[model samples]
Target chain A: MSVQSKPRVRVPATAAKGELIEIKTLISHEMESGQRKDSAGKAIPRKIINKFTAAFDGKVVFEADWQPAISVNPYQSFFYKAQKSGAFTFKWKDDDGSEYTAESKLTVT
Target chain B: MPNWFGIRTATATRRQALTAGAAGALAVLLPRMVLADEAAVADALKKLYGGKAMAEGRIKLDVPPIAENGLVVPIGVEVESPMTEADYVKAVHVFADGNPLPGVVSYRFTPDCGKAAAATRMRLAQTQNVVCVAEMSNGTLFTAKSNVKVTIGGCGG
Candidate 1:
Protein backbone atom coordinates (compact mmCIF):
# COMPACT_ATOMS: atom_id res chain seq x y z
CA MET A 1 0.00 0.00 0.00
CA SER A 2 1.65 3.19 -1.16
CA VAL A 3 -0.85 5.45 0.59
CA GLN A 4 -1.78 5.74 4.23
CA SER A 5 -5.17 4.26 5.10
CA LYS A 6 -7.17 5.22 8.17
CA PRO A 7 -10.14 3.35 9.65
CA ARG A 8 -12.62 4.89 12.07
CA VAL A 9 -15.54 3.28 13.86
CA ARG A 10 -18.47 4.70 15.80
CA VAL A 11 -20.15 2.53 18.41
CA PRO A 12 -22.22 3.58 21.34
CA ALA A 13 -20.52 3.34 24.69
CA THR A 14 -23.62 1.91 26.30
CA ALA A 15 -26.64 -0.04 25.17
CA ALA A 16 -29.44 -2.02 26.71
CA LYS A 17 -29.55 -5.75 26.33
CA GLY A 18 -31.18 -6.81 23.07
CA GLU A 19 -30.71 -3.29 21.75
CA LEU A 20 -30.24 -2.83 18.06
CA ILE A 21 -27.50 -0.26 17.82
CA GLU A 22 -26.19 1.25 14.67
CA ILE A 23 -22.49 0.79 13.94
CA LYS A 24 -20.81 3.12 11.50
CA THR A 25 -17.40 2.64 9.97
CA LEU A 26 -15.45 4.74 7.54
CA ILE A 27 -12.07 4.42 5.87
CA SER A 28 -10.00 6.60 3.60
CA HIS A 29 -8.86 5.17 0.27
CA GLU A 30 -8.63 6.31 -3.31
CA MET A 31 -10.61 3.25 -4.56
CA GLU A 32 -9.24 3.57 -8.07
CA SER A 33 -11.86 1.81 -10.23
CA GLY A 34 -9.53 0.92 -13.12
CA GLN A 35 -11.92 2.79 -15.41
CA ARG A 36 -9.91 5.97 -15.38
CA LYS A 37 -6.99 6.71 -17.68
CA ASP A 38 -3.85 8.57 -16.76
CA SER A 39 -2.35 11.49 -18.63
CA ALA A 40 -0.78 9.07 -21.11
CA GLY A 41 -4.20 7.56 -21.91
CA LYS A 42 -3.46 4.36 -20.00
CA ALA A 43 -5.99 2.75 -17.71
CA ILE A 44 -5.21 3.24 -14.07
CA PRO A 45 -4.72 0.10 -12.08
CA ARG A 46 -7.52 -0.65 -9.63
CA LYS A 47 -6.57 -0.51 -5.98
CA ILE A 48 -9.39 -0.61 -3.46
CA ILE A 49 -10.57 -2.16 -0.25
CA ASN A 50 -12.39 -5.15 -1.66
CA LYS A 51 -13.78 -6.56 1.59
CA PHE A 52 -15.06 -5.23 4.90
CA THR A 53 -15.90 -7.30 7.95
CA ALA A 54 -17.23 -6.66 11.44
CA ALA A 55 -16.76 -9.04 14.30
CA PHE A 56 -17.75 -9.14 17.95
CA ASP A 57 -15.65 -11.27 20.28
CA GLY A 58 -14.06 -12.92 17.25
CA LYS A 59 -17.43 -13.88 15.76
CA VAL A 60 -18.18 -12.39 12.38
CA VAL A 61 -21.38 -10.39 12.35
CA PHE A 62 -21.48 -8.38 9.14
CA GLU A 63 -19.47 -8.52 5.94
CA ALA A 64 -19.44 -6.49 2.75
CA ASP A 65 -17.90 -7.19 -0.66
CA TRP A 66 -17.16 -3.85 -2.23
CA GLN A 67 -16.75 -3.30 -5.95
CA PRO A 68 -14.73 -0.62 -7.64
CA ALA A 69 -17.73 1.69 -7.69
CA ILE A 70 -17.57 2.49 -4.00
CA SER A 71 -16.73 6.05 -3.16
CA VAL A 72 -13.19 7.27 -2.55
CA ASN A 73 -13.65 7.16 1.24
CA PRO A 74 -15.97 4.30 1.98
CA TYR A 75 -18.60 4.85 4.66
CA GLN A 76 -20.64 1.87 5.81
CA SER A 77 -23.18 1.51 8.57
CA PHE A 78 -25.09 -1.46 9.95
CA PHE A 79 -27.10 -2.56 12.93
CA TYR A 80 -25.85 -4.97 15.59
CA LYS A 81 -27.61 -6.53 18.54
CA ALA A 82 -25.96 -5.63 21.77
CA GLN A 83 -26.20 -8.80 23.80
CA LYS A 84 -23.18 -8.33 25.97
CA SER A 85 -20.28 -5.99 26.52
CA GLY A 86 -17.59 -6.64 23.98
CA ALA A 87 -15.22 -5.11 21.51
CA PHE A 88 -16.15 -4.95 17.87
CA THR A 89 -13.34 -5.37 15.35
CA PHE A 90 -13.64 -3.86 11.89
CA LYS A 91 -11.38 -5.05 9.11
CA TRP A 92 -10.88 -3.66 5.61
CA LYS A 93 -8.97 -5.83 3.15
CA ASP A 94 -7.40 -4.10 0.20
CA ASP A 95 -6.58 -5.36 -3.29
CA ASP A 96 -2.87 -5.70 -2.44
CA GLY A 97 -3.74 -8.13 0.36
CA SER A 98 -3.32 -5.45 2.96
CA GLU A 99 -5.65 -5.46 5.96
CA TYR A 100 -6.59 -2.33 7.91
CA THR A 101 -8.27 -2.87 11.26
CA ALA A 102 -9.96 -0.75 13.92
CA GLU A 103 -11.77 -1.57 17.16
CA SER A 104 -14.51 -0.05 19.27
CA LYS A 105 -16.05 -1.13 22.52
CA LEU A 106 -19.69 -1.29 23.53
CA THR A 107 -21.07 -1.81 26.99
CA VAL A 108 -24.39 -3.61 27.23
CA THR A 109 -26.44 -3.68 30.40
CA MET B 1 -20.63 -7.18 -21.63
CA PRO B 2 -19.30 -8.74 -24.81
CA ASN B 3 -19.88 -5.49 -26.66
CA TRP B 4 -17.72 -3.42 -24.36
CA PHE B 5 -15.50 -2.78 -27.33
CA GLY B 6 -16.00 -3.03 -31.09
CA ILE B 7 -13.88 -4.99 -33.54
CA ARG B 8 -10.96 -2.90 -34.73
CA THR B 9 -10.95 -1.80 -38.38
CA ALA B 10 -7.24 -1.10 -38.47
CA THR B 11 -5.27 -2.46 -41.37
CA ALA B 12 -3.73 -5.78 -40.48
CA THR B 13 -0.03 -6.19 -40.99
CA ARG B 14 1.33 -9.11 -42.98
CA ARG B 15 2.43 -10.94 -39.83
CA GLN B 16 -0.55 -9.98 -37.64
CA ALA B 17 -3.66 -11.49 -39.21
CA LEU B 18 -7.23 -10.77 -38.04
CA THR B 19 -7.25 -13.82 -35.80
CA ALA B 20 -8.65 -14.20 -32.35
CA GLY B 21 -5.26 -13.46 -30.85
CA ALA B 22 -4.97 -10.33 -32.93
CA ALA B 23 -8.46 -9.27 -31.95
CA GLY B 24 -7.59 -9.70 -28.33
CA ALA B 25 -4.39 -7.76 -28.86
CA LEU B 26 -6.27 -5.04 -30.67
CA ALA B 27 -8.78 -4.84 -27.85
CA VAL B 28 -5.96 -4.13 -25.46
CA LEU B 29 -4.30 -1.66 -27.79
CA LEU B 30 -7.42 0.43 -28.42
CA PRO B 31 -9.01 2.60 -25.75
CA ARG B 32 -12.61 1.51 -25.74
CA MET B 33 -15.08 3.30 -23.50
CA VAL B 34 -16.95 0.74 -21.43
CA LEU B 35 -19.94 1.10 -19.14
CA ALA B 36 -22.48 -1.36 -17.81
CA ASP B 37 -26.08 -0.96 -18.88
CA GLU B 38 -29.42 -2.38 -17.78
CA ALA B 39 -28.73 -5.59 -19.66
CA ALA B 40 -25.55 -6.10 -17.69
CA VAL B 41 -27.44 -5.66 -14.47
CA ALA B 42 -30.01 -8.21 -15.58
CA ASP B 43 -27.26 -10.65 -16.50
CA ALA B 44 -25.67 -10.29 -13.09
CA LEU B 45 -28.98 -10.96 -11.39
CA LYS B 46 -29.65 -13.98 -13.57
CA LYS B 47 -26.22 -15.37 -12.80
CA LEU B 48 -26.79 -15.00 -9.07
CA TYR B 49 -30.38 -16.22 -8.89
CA GLY B 50 -30.21 -18.83 -11.66
CA GLY B 51 -33.71 -18.20 -12.96
CA LYS B 52 -35.22 -18.08 -9.51
CA ALA B 53 -38.17 -15.75 -9.24
CA MET B 54 -37.68 -12.82 -6.91
CA ALA B 55 -40.69 -11.49 -5.11
CA GLU B 56 -41.02 -7.74 -4.97
CA GLY B 57 -41.60 -6.99 -1.28
CA ARG B 58 -39.97 -6.63 2.11
CA ILE B 59 -37.13 -4.69 0.55
CA LYS B 60 -36.52 -0.97 0.64
CA LEU B 61 -33.94 1.16 -1.15
CA ASP B 62 -33.00 4.62 0.08
CA VAL B 63 -31.37 6.73 -2.58
CA PRO B 64 -31.83 10.32 -3.49
CA PRO B 65 -33.93 10.95 -6.57
CA ILE B 66 -31.40 13.57 -7.58
CA ALA B 67 -27.86 13.56 -6.37
CA GLU B 68 -25.89 16.73 -5.76
CA ASN B 69 -22.66 14.92 -6.50
CA GLY B 70 -21.88 11.69 -8.28
CA LEU B 71 -18.70 10.92 -6.41
CA VAL B 72 -20.50 10.12 -3.17
CA VAL B 73 -24.10 9.10 -3.58
CA PRO B 74 -25.39 7.69 -0.33
CA ILE B 75 -27.39 4.48 -0.71
CA GLY B 76 -29.22 2.40 1.85
CA VAL B 77 -30.96 -0.96 1.79
CA GLU B 78 -33.15 -2.68 4.34
CA VAL B 79 -34.90 -6.03 4.20
CA GLU B 80 -37.65 -7.02 6.58
CA SER B 81 -36.49 -9.98 8.61
CA PRO B 82 -36.69 -11.29 12.15
CA MET B 83 -32.94 -11.36 12.51
CA THR B 84 -33.23 -14.68 14.28
CA GLU B 85 -31.27 -17.79 13.59
CA ALA B 86 -34.22 -19.43 11.91
CA ASP B 87 -35.21 -16.42 9.77
CA TYR B 88 -32.70 -13.83 8.68
CA VAL B 89 -31.37 -12.13 5.62
CA LYS B 90 -28.54 -14.16 4.16
CA ALA B 91 -27.12 -11.60 1.79
CA VAL B 92 -27.79 -8.39 -0.13
CA HIS B 93 -26.22 -7.67 -3.52
CA VAL B 94 -26.41 -4.30 -5.21
CA PHE B 95 -26.01 -3.43 -8.89
CA ALA B 96 -25.97 -0.28 -10.96
CA ASP B 97 -27.22 0.09 -14.51
CA GLY B 98 -24.93 2.91 -15.59
CA ASN B 99 -21.46 2.27 -14.21
CA PRO B 100 -18.24 0.74 -15.34
CA LEU B 101 -19.48 -2.54 -13.87
CA PRO B 102 -22.84 -3.79 -12.80
CA GLY B 103 -21.72 -5.11 -9.44
CA VAL B 104 -21.55 -2.44 -6.79
CA VAL B 105 -21.57 -4.06 -3.35
CA SER B 106 -22.60 -7.33 -1.71
CA TYR B 107 -23.50 -7.67 1.97
CA ARG B 108 -23.66 -10.73 4.23
CA PHE B 109 -25.55 -10.41 7.45
CA THR B 110 -25.64 -12.79 10.37
CA PRO B 111 -28.18 -13.21 13.10
CA ASP B 112 -26.08 -11.01 15.32
CA CYS B 113 -27.20 -8.13 13.21
CA GLY B 114 -30.46 -7.16 14.87
CA LYS B 115 -31.58 -5.57 11.62
CA ALA B 116 -30.94 -6.66 8.08
CA ALA B 117 -29.99 -3.23 6.86
CA ALA B 118 -26.88 -1.52 5.58
CA ALA B 119 -25.80 1.79 4.11
CA THR B 120 -22.87 2.96 2.04
CA ARG B 121 -21.79 5.52 -0.53
CA MET B 122 -21.04 4.81 -4.18
CA ARG B 123 -19.88 6.46 -7.39
CA LEU B 124 -22.21 6.97 -10.32
CA ALA B 125 -21.00 7.65 -13.83
CA GLN B 126 -24.32 9.25 -14.71
CA THR B 127 -27.97 9.20 -13.92
CA GLN B 128 -28.90 5.55 -13.44
CA ASN B 129 -30.94 3.09 -11.51
CA VAL B 130 -29.54 1.11 -8.60
CA VAL B 131 -30.89 -2.40 -8.17
CA CYS B 132 -30.60 -4.38 -4.98
CA VAL B 133 -31.49 -7.98 -4.15
CA ALA B 134 -31.75 -9.77 -0.84
CA GLU B 135 -31.62 -13.49 -0.15
CA MET B 136 -33.30 -14.86 2.91
CA SER B 137 -32.34 -17.80 5.08
CA ASN B 138 -35.23 -19.86 3.74
CA GLY B 139 -34.03 -19.52 0.15
CA THR B 140 -36.34 -16.65 -0.69
CA LEU B 141 -35.36 -13.58 -2.65
CA PHE B 142 -36.53 -9.95 -2.65
CA THR B 143 -35.55 -7.01 -4.78
CA ALA B 144 -35.80 -3.24 -5.01
CA LYS B 145 -34.49 -0.46 -7.22
CA SER B 146 -34.20 3.32 -7.27
CA ASN B 147 -33.04 5.87 -9.81
CA VAL B 148 -30.75 8.79 -9.14
CA LYS B 149 -29.92 11.74 -11.34
CA VAL B 150 -26.41 13.09 -10.97
CA THR B 151 -25.47 16.67 -11.67
CA ILE B 152 -21.85 15.77 -12.32
CA GLY B 153 -20.52 12.45 -13.53
CA GLY B 154 -17.95 10.85 -11.26
CA CYS B 155 -16.25 8.12 -13.33
CA GLY B 156 -14.60 10.14 -16.03
CA GLY B 157 -10.84 10.01 -16.40
Candidate 2:
Protein backbone atom coordinates (compact mmCIF):
# COMPACT_ATOMS: atom_id res chain seq x y z
CA MET A 1 0.00 0.00 0.00
CA SER A 2 1.14 3.58 -0.59
CA VAL A 3 2.56 5.09 2.58
CA GLN A 4 0.36 8.13 2.46
CA SER A 5 -2.53 9.60 0.51
CA LYS A 6 -2.49 13.17 -0.80
CA PRO A 7 -2.52 16.04 1.68
CA ARG A 8 -4.67 19.17 1.56
CA VAL A 9 -3.46 22.63 2.56
CA ARG A 10 -5.31 25.93 2.76
CA VAL A 11 -4.31 29.52 3.56
CA PRO A 12 -6.18 32.77 3.34
CA ALA A 13 -6.10 34.44 -0.10
CA THR A 14 -5.40 37.84 1.36
CA ALA A 15 -3.96 39.20 4.56
CA ALA A 16 -3.15 42.63 5.91
CA LYS A 17 0.52 43.33 5.82
CA GLY A 18 2.05 42.04 9.10
CA GLU A 19 -1.13 40.14 9.90
CA LEU A 20 -0.86 36.76 11.54
CA ILE A 21 -2.40 34.27 9.09
CA GLU A 22 -3.76 30.83 9.83
CA ILE A 23 -2.74 27.72 7.91
CA LYS A 24 -4.54 24.39 7.89
CA THR A 25 -3.35 21.02 6.64
CA LEU A 26 -4.58 17.42 6.58
CA ILE A 27 -3.16 14.10 5.42
CA SER A 28 -4.89 10.87 4.46
CA HIS A 29 -3.30 8.10 6.45
CA GLU A 30 -3.92 4.92 8.36
CA MET A 31 -1.75 5.33 11.46
CA GLU A 32 -1.73 1.66 12.43
CA SER A 33 -0.57 0.82 15.93
CA GLY A 34 1.86 -2.10 16.11
CA GLN A 35 -0.21 -3.60 18.90
CA ARG A 36 -3.16 -4.31 16.63
CA LYS A 37 -3.94 -7.90 15.76
CA ASP A 38 -5.01 -9.11 12.34
CA SER A 39 -7.95 -11.43 11.65
CA ALA A 40 -5.63 -14.36 12.22
CA GLY A 41 -4.69 -12.82 15.59
CA LYS A 42 -1.18 -11.97 14.36
CA ALA A 43 0.15 -8.58 15.46
CA ILE A 44 -0.19 -5.88 12.81
CA PRO A 45 3.17 -4.22 12.37
CA ARG A 46 3.01 -0.50 13.03
CA LYS A 47 2.78 1.88 10.11
CA ILE A 48 2.65 5.60 10.93
CA ILE A 49 3.55 9.10 9.75
CA ASN A 50 6.17 10.13 12.26
CA LYS A 51 7.05 13.69 11.31
CA PHE A 52 5.61 16.91 9.91
CA THR A 53 7.12 20.27 9.03
CA ALA A 54 5.90 23.64 7.75
CA ALA A 55 8.26 26.02 6.05
CA PHE A 56 7.60 29.53 4.83
CA ASP A 57 9.74 31.03 2.07
CA GLY A 58 12.56 28.52 2.75
CA LYS A 59 12.51 29.24 6.50
CA VAL A 60 11.12 26.67 8.92
CA VAL A 61 7.88 27.81 10.53
CA PHE A 62 6.71 24.64 12.26
CA GLU A 63 7.88 21.04 12.71
CA ALA A 64 6.64 17.99 14.68
CA ASP A 65 7.39 14.33 15.35
CA TRP A 66 4.58 11.81 15.76
CA GLN A 67 4.46 8.38 17.31
CA PRO A 68 2.74 5.16 16.23
CA ALA A 69 -0.40 6.07 18.19
CA ILE A 70 -1.45 9.05 16.04
CA SER A 71 -4.84 8.63 14.40
CA VAL A 72 -5.48 8.26 10.70
CA ASN A 73 -5.82 11.37 8.54
CA PRO A 74 -4.06 13.60 11.06
CA TYR A 75 -5.12 17.23 10.84
CA GLN A 76 -3.11 20.28 11.94
CA SER A 77 -3.98 23.95 12.17
CA PHE A 78 -1.51 26.70 13.04
CA PHE A 79 -0.57 30.38 12.56
CA TYR A 80 2.30 32.53 11.27
CA LYS A 81 2.45 36.30 11.08
CA ALA A 82 2.89 37.35 7.47
CA GLN A 83 6.29 38.97 7.09
CA LYS A 84 6.10 39.08 3.29
CA SER A 85 4.01 37.37 0.62
CA GLY A 86 5.45 33.96 -0.10
CA ALA A 87 4.74 30.23 -0.27
CA PHE A 88 4.37 27.91 2.72
CA THR A 89 5.45 24.30 2.27
CA PHE A 90 4.01 21.52 4.44
CA LYS A 91 5.67 18.11 4.55
CA TRP A 92 4.59 14.85 6.20
CA LYS A 93 6.85 11.82 6.60
CA ASP A 94 6.28 8.25 7.71
CA ASP A 95 8.38 5.84 9.74
CA ASP A 96 8.99 3.67 6.68
CA GLY A 97 10.76 6.63 5.04
CA SER A 98 8.18 8.14 2.72
CA GLU A 99 7.35 11.81 2.37
CA TYR A 100 4.43 13.90 1.02
CA THR A 101 4.31 17.64 0.45
CA ALA A 102 1.71 20.40 -0.01
CA GLU A 103 2.06 24.17 -0.41
CA SER A 104 -0.03 27.33 -0.12
CA LYS A 105 0.72 30.96 -0.89
CA LEU A 106 -0.38 34.09 0.93
CA THR A 107 -0.84 37.53 -0.58
CA VAL A 108 -0.09 40.60 1.50
CA THR A 109 -2.14 43.66 0.67
CA MET B 1 -21.18 -25.26 57.99
CA PRO B 2 -20.90 -21.65 59.27
CA ASN B 3 -18.07 -20.77 56.83
CA TRP B 4 -19.96 -22.28 53.91
CA PHE B 5 -23.07 -20.32 54.84
CA GLY B 6 -21.12 -17.02 55.02
CA ILE B 7 -19.48 -17.61 51.66
CA ARG B 8 -22.79 -18.40 50.03
CA THR B 9 -24.42 -15.31 51.57
CA ALA B 10 -21.64 -13.09 50.33
CA THR B 11 -21.99 -14.36 46.77
CA ALA B 12 -25.74 -13.76 46.91
CA THR B 13 -25.51 -10.15 48.14
CA ARG B 14 -24.12 -6.61 47.60
CA ARG B 15 -20.55 -7.79 47.05
CA GLN B 16 -21.61 -9.88 44.10
CA ALA B 17 -23.56 -7.03 42.51
CA LEU B 18 -20.71 -4.56 42.87
CA THR B 19 -18.20 -7.02 41.47
CA ALA B 20 -20.42 -7.87 38.53
CA GLY B 21 -21.17 -4.22 37.76
CA ALA B 22 -17.57 -3.14 37.89
CA ALA B 23 -16.47 -6.03 35.71
CA GLY B 24 -19.22 -5.43 33.16
CA ALA B 25 -18.51 -1.73 32.89
CA LEU B 26 -14.81 -2.35 32.57
CA ALA B 27 -15.29 -4.94 29.89
CA VAL B 28 -17.42 -2.56 27.87
CA LEU B 29 -15.21 0.48 28.33
CA LEU B 30 -11.72 -1.04 28.28
CA PRO B 31 -11.14 -0.76 24.53
CA ARG B 32 -12.44 2.78 24.37
CA MET B 33 -10.46 3.90 27.38
CA VAL B 34 -7.20 2.64 25.94
CA LEU B 35 -7.91 4.04 22.54
CA ALA B 36 -8.76 7.42 24.02
CA ASP B 37 -5.35 7.61 25.64
CA GLU B 38 -3.71 8.99 22.49
CA ALA B 39 -2.82 12.72 22.43
CA ALA B 40 -0.79 14.17 19.55
CA VAL B 41 -0.99 17.71 20.86
CA ALA B 42 0.69 16.93 24.16
CA ASP B 43 3.65 15.35 22.39
CA ALA B 44 4.03 18.44 20.24
CA LEU B 45 3.91 20.72 23.26
CA LYS B 46 6.90 19.16 24.96
CA LYS B 47 8.96 19.07 21.79
CA LEU B 48 8.59 22.78 21.19
CA TYR B 49 8.50 24.17 24.69
CA GLY B 50 10.73 21.70 26.45
CA GLY B 51 12.21 22.96 29.75
CA LYS B 52 10.16 26.14 29.62
CA ALA B 53 7.74 27.19 32.31
CA MET B 54 4.20 27.71 31.00
CA ALA B 55 1.85 30.14 32.70
CA GLU B 56 -1.88 30.63 32.27
CA GLY B 57 -3.11 33.90 30.75
CA ARG B 58 -5.89 35.79 28.90
CA ILE B 59 -5.06 33.82 25.75
CA LYS B 60 -8.46 32.68 24.52
CA LEU B 61 -9.16 29.30 23.03
CA ASP B 62 -12.23 29.37 20.80
CA VAL B 63 -13.72 25.90 20.72
CA PRO B 64 -16.92 24.21 21.68
CA PRO B 65 -16.77 23.23 25.31
CA ILE B 66 -18.80 20.22 24.23
CA ALA B 67 -18.13 18.63 20.86
CA GLU B 68 -20.93 16.58 19.35
CA ASN B 69 -18.65 14.83 16.89
CA GLY B 70 -15.39 13.37 18.07
CA LEU B 71 -13.71 13.00 14.68
CA VAL B 72 -13.50 16.63 13.70
CA VAL B 73 -13.73 19.36 16.33
CA PRO B 74 -13.15 23.00 15.45
CA ILE B 75 -10.65 24.81 17.67
CA GLY B 76 -9.04 28.22 17.76
CA VAL B 77 -6.41 29.81 20.01
CA GLU B 78 -5.58 33.51 20.11
CA VAL B 79 -3.04 35.16 22.37
CA GLU B 80 -2.24 38.80 22.93
CA SER B 81 1.08 39.74 21.41
CA PRO B 82 2.93 43.00 20.85
CA MET B 83 3.98 41.80 17.37
CA THR B 84 7.29 43.64 17.38
CA GLU B 85 10.54 42.30 16.01
CA ALA B 86 12.26 42.62 19.38
CA ASP B 87 9.47 41.02 21.45
CA TYR B 88 6.85 39.71 19.07
CA VAL B 89 5.13 36.33 19.17
CA LYS B 90 7.49 33.58 18.15
CA ALA B 91 5.57 30.33 17.75
CA VAL B 92 2.19 28.84 18.62
CA HIS B 93 1.77 25.19 19.51
CA VAL B 94 -1.51 23.37 20.15
CA PHE B 95 -1.97 20.05 21.90
CA ALA B 96 -4.64 17.55 22.86
CA ASP B 97 -2.68 16.51 25.90
CA GLY B 98 -4.65 13.38 26.67
CA ASN B 99 -4.91 12.00 23.17
CA PRO B 100 -2.72 9.08 22.09
CA LEU B 101 0.12 11.36 20.98
CA PRO B 102 -0.40 14.50 23.10
CA GLY B 103 1.60 16.52 20.55
CA VAL B 104 -0.93 17.14 17.80
CA VAL B 105 0.62 20.10 15.91
CA SER B 106 3.14 22.96 16.06
CA TYR B 107 3.24 26.35 14.31
CA ARG B 108 6.34 28.54 14.37
CA PHE B 109 5.97 32.20 13.77
CA THR B 110 7.59 35.63 13.67
CA PRO B 111 6.65 39.26 14.29
CA ASP B 112 5.20 39.46 10.80
CA CYS B 113 2.13 37.63 12.05
CA GLY B 114 0.59 40.85 13.40
CA LYS B 115 -0.99 38.82 16.15
CA ALA B 116 -0.81 35.36 17.65
CA ALA B 117 -3.62 33.04 16.54
CA ALA B 118 -4.51 29.69 14.98
CA ALA B 119 -7.66 27.79 14.02
CA THR B 120 -8.12 24.28 12.80
CA ARG B 121 -10.13 21.07 13.09
CA MET B 122 -8.66 17.94 14.61
CA ARG B 123 -9.71 14.40 15.53
CA LEU B 124 -9.96 13.92 19.25
CA ALA B 125 -9.95 10.42 20.69
CA GLN B 126 -12.00 11.60 23.61
CA THR B 127 -12.70 14.53 25.88
CA GLN B 128 -9.30 15.94 26.72
CA ASN B 129 -7.12 18.97 27.39
CA VAL B 130 -6.65 21.29 24.44
CA VAL B 131 -3.55 23.28 25.34
CA CYS B 132 -2.12 26.33 23.56
CA VAL B 133 1.47 27.44 24.06
CA ALA B 134 2.90 30.61 22.60
CA GLU B 135 6.64 31.19 22.47
CA MET B 136 7.74 34.78 22.30
CA SER B 137 10.80 35.97 20.46
CA ASN B 138 12.27 37.10 23.76
CA GLY B 139 12.43 33.40 24.80
CA THR B 140 9.37 33.32 27.03
CA LEU B 141 6.45 30.92 26.82
CA PHE B 142 2.80 31.67 27.61
CA THR B 143 0.08 29.07 27.80
CA ALA B 144 -3.68 28.53 28.00
CA LYS B 145 -5.72 25.35 28.22
CA SER B 146 -9.34 24.25 28.11
CA ASN B 147 -11.10 20.94 28.62
CA VAL B 148 -13.39 19.78 25.84
CA LYS B 149 -16.04 17.25 26.74
CA VAL B 150 -16.77 14.78 23.98
CA THR B 151 -19.84 12.58 24.15
CA ILE B 152 -18.86 9.91 21.65
CA GLY B 153 -15.18 8.98 21.39
CA GLY B 154 -13.45 9.71 18.07
CA CYS B 155 -10.57 7.22 18.23
CA GLY B 156 -11.99 4.43 16.13
CA GLY B 157 -15.21 4.80 17.98
For residues B47-119, what per-residue lDDT tens digits would candidate 2 score against the true structure?
6666568777847888799988766677776778776667777666667765655555555555545566665
The TM-score that candidate 2 achieves is: 0.67
Fnat per candidate, as a fraction, reads 0.92, 0.37
lDDT of each: 0.91, 0.71
Clashes of each: 0, 23
Give a tens-digit lDDT track for model 1, residues B1-157. 4343333323344336657678897688545657799899989988988879988989999999999899999999999999999999999999999998999999999999999999999999889999999999999999898999999988877
Chain A TM-score, each candidate: 0.97, 0.91
Docking class of 1: medium
> What is candidate 1's DockQ?
0.74
Q: TM-score per model for chain B alone?
A: 0.78, 0.72
lDDT of 1 at B82: 91
lDDT tens digits, residues A1-109, model 1?
A: 5669999889999999999999999998989988899999888899999999999999999999999999998999999999999999999999999999999889998
TM-score of 1: 0.87
Chain A, candidate 1, TM-score of 0.97
Cα-based lDDT at residue B134, candidate 2? 76
